[model samples]
Target: IEGPDLISKLRSEHGVSVPVLMLTERRELSDKIRAFRSGADDYVTKPFDIPELEVRLQAIVNRAQGRPATRRLTDGGLTLDLATLIASREGRQLRLYPGTRKLLQVLMRASPSAVSRQELEHALWGDDPPDRDLLRSHMSAL
Candidate 1:
């Protein structure tokens, strides 16, 4: 993804539930850290073996699909219906934008721990990234 902002938009707007695998030639440790902080589940350096990538993709998909997963999560006054994408607090619906909904889902899943920025960006933008400033604007608006 080239546009940092678009990536942010996707993370904030779409309820992307899968892990993002970054396929890139950049191998610097700093780059890796940036990717993870952006919300990437895994980062594969370029010139990688195809077989290994396939296996990794499968594993990520399986985990995301809830193969051997736990059900239900409740925190504070909110209850999340993961399967149905419904979240409510005290039987009252909490209004949310599309991006906020996705953000909530990720945050709820990673409760008590900080979700990486890279992971969030990947979930939002995929391979075609957007401008960072634009993303920041959207987030602020949200």
Candidate 2:
């Protein structure tokens, strides 16, 4: 969860309905914009006040809970339904194996970047060591 991809998974796969409050020391405007674009609801720069941070988080949580339901997800030409875990690209439903489906979901959520082999293995196998060809097979199938 400490890795960069964690945020995307939290937002996309886990369906975290609450706002995300990111705490970072980065001072650049581009960095802040990137964090927001990557699904952070709010970014708190470093050297922050604990009380202020708590208050902001509380406000965000309250507001999110009061909002309407969200139904659809679209990334580029691909669309997915969070309720059904169904995905389609360019109006065609992509047939995917169960494992491959899960892998695709993770990858799609973290699109425009490469997800490390270790991250995928951990997601699919947990703490146990998976078969050497497991990921390769899944990727190929995908």
Candidate 3:
């Protein structure tokens, strides 16, 4: 009937790896501790900021799923600088055009997961995409 009870039931019925974020009106320390001990991943009291709550939920899910918050992406000797939009391999900077950079960013972010051709096209150009198969050209450039 309560958050802790629900968490216990979920973990038992499902698995312990299930992520749980408890948002409740109970502000007491004892209540928070109890909820956590019963397997709640995060505790946010009422009157919390929406953005903060969203971030906390994302953090919990990331931890549960073993995915870190990605700023830069890297593989082998190649690296993609997310902030500066510079990509390099083995200390040598690789030239990337605007469209190619965008494609690389999207593809790297979705690494280890297959991305469909349609998704790549959507990322390159929203609804009004070019009528030609320009995605292949960008892929070649990247």
Candidate 4:
């Protein structure tokens, strides 16, 4: 049997959930369908872009780890998508600077649980720790 066939056997016999992306020279609708039916998460033909493949693998890892690919946070009708860094409130977008966007992402992910100022500070500024008032300024801006 071929690679796809072997993969199907592994899935059925071992109950493996690891994402599989089939990269092959075989390009046919039936081939692709068979791979998917056999438990492949993705299928890519030959001559594909490397960067795009990397993105797909990252998405698989993210899904396996239970982290949302979109990386979204919502609270009180405010929607923040960290992937695109778009923040919206009540279906309307709130223009946010990059720094403000980062601030909102951290805060929303920790929703229902208070994140210490120090934690936020570290998230925003890393080890350098910004001036004491900087975090307050970002919050106010948000």
TM-scores across all candidates? 0.44, 0.47, 0.50, 0.54
Please give the TM-score that candidate 1 achieves against the real structure.
0.44
RMSD of each: 15.7, 15.5, 7.5, 7.3
Q: Tens digits of per-residue lDDT for model 2 on 1-142?
A: 4322566777789887556788888879987877777688888988997545644664576578784343345779887654455778998987776677667656765777889988888767778857869799998987
What is the C-alpha lDDT profile of model 1 across 1-142, one tens digit per residue?
A: 5422334456668855457888888888987887776667788987987545755675577688877433445778887665445678888876666555556666776788987867666656666658776546545643
Candidate 4 global TM-score: 0.54
Ten residues in a row with the worst lDDT in model 3? 50-59
Pairs in steric clash, model 4: none
For candidate 3, write residues 30-93 as lDDT tens digits: 9999999989989999989754674576578668789985556787777887656688989999
- For each candidate, the alpha-carbon lDDT, in order, equals 0.66, 0.71, 0.80, 0.82
lDDT top scorer:
4
Residue-level lDDT tens digits of model 4 in 1-142 = 8877888889999988788988989899999999999898898899997545755775787788998775567899999865466789999999997678777777887888899988888878889987889888999998
RMSD (CA, Å), candidate 3 to true, equals 7.5
lDDT pick, better of 3 and 4 = 4
Q: Judged by TM-score relative to the true structure, which candidate is superior, 1 or 2?
A: 2
lDDT of 3 at 67: 92
